[model samples]
Target chain A: AQTVTQSQPEMSVQEAETVTLSCTYDTSESDYYLFWYKQPPSRQMILVIRQEAYKQQNATENRFSVNFQKAAKSFSLKISDSQLGDAAMYFCAYRRRTSYDKVIFGPGTSLSVIP
Target chain B: DAGVTQSPTHLIKTRGQQVTLRCSPKSGHDTVSWYQQALGQGPQFIFQYYEEEERQRGNFPDRFSGHQFPNYSSELNVNALLLGDSALYLCASSFWTGQGIYEQYFGPGTRLTVT
Candidate 1:
């Protein structure tokens, strides 16, 4: 069985600053996918960024990027130049590379962007 | 293109009653996955449907069943609902590339309240 862990229950960052949310997982599979999703109060889950296990280079999507340490099984999300719109509940998720594998999600970390 | 869509934004049902939630996949997406997210917790995978069949399921009970229509629309049916079943139901859609599934697009979830 695989499990995802988000150590921070809540985080806050000043607008225009930077913050990092930590995540770690346990899995036996050699190759898989890791993701960061943001859910606003509107209840829509939005994909922030994703990383492929086999890719040694970390994934980056504009202001959102991941620090994926495969050997340590740690995947963290760093938000640079944070904005008020970035305030939301962020979830760390995992999925296998297999065709139809179900996703595993960690308890979210609520982020507050201080203006 | 329109992202994934879910119906009946909110639903309130009594304990032991049954409820059904509907989802329409994003345009050109053929695979649909369902997840349950409790208050303050991350979404938990319930199942995934592809080719009108269930291809993967999580640790949920049989009371949680689903169906995928020929048009790629899907429905999640929860029978004899319990208070524990109250949560936000999220539907995600992705393209299946024969070898794997692409990044998923999520819908604004349906909030189910069992009282």
Candidate 2:
């Protein structure tokens, strides 16, 4: 069984500033994927970014990027130039690279973008 | 054009009662997955359905059953529900992964309240 852990229960960052959310997972499987999801107060869940275990390079999506440290089993999400819309509950998830595989999510970190 | 969708945005049921939740996969998606998200916690995987069959399941008990229709729609059924069953039930969909990790799209989720 794979378990994801997000140590930061809550985080705050000023608008236009950069923030990094910590995420760590324990998985025996060598081939898997990691993901970041955002859920606003409206409860709409959205994908932010993803990374494959085999890839040593990180994944970047516009303002969102990840620092994937495979050796430490750490996949942290860095939000550069954070916006107000970035204030939400960020969840770290793990998924197998197999067909119809299930995903496990972390407890989540509530990010507050202050103006 | 539609993303993943779940029916009965909110539902209230009594303990020991049964409940059914529906889901509609996103356009061009063929795999559907169910999850349970508690009040401040991350979503827990329930099961994944593809081609009208349950391809994977979580550690949930037999009380949690599901069905997928020929149209790619799915339903989650819980028998003899308990108070702990109250949570936001989320439905997500992704393109069938013959070989790659496709990002999943989620719905707003169906909030189930067991009183």
On residues A3-112, what C-alpha lDDT tens digit does candidate 2 reach at each position? 99999999999999999999999998998989999999999999999899998889999999999998899999999999999999999999877766888999999999
> B7, model 2: CA deviation in Å?
0.7
DockQ of 2: 0.89
lDDT of 1 by residue, B59-91 (tens): 999999999999999999999999999999999
Q: Please give fnat for model 2.
A: 0.95
Q: What does candidate 2 score in Cα RMSD to the true structure?
A: 1.2
What value does the lDDT take at residue A108 in candidate 2? Answer: 100
The CA lDDT at A112 in model 2 is 100
CAPRI quality band, candidate 1: high
Candidate 1, number of clashes: 0
The regions of model 1 sitting more than 4 angstroms off are: B97-101
Model 2 alpha-carbon miss at residue B2, Å: 1.2
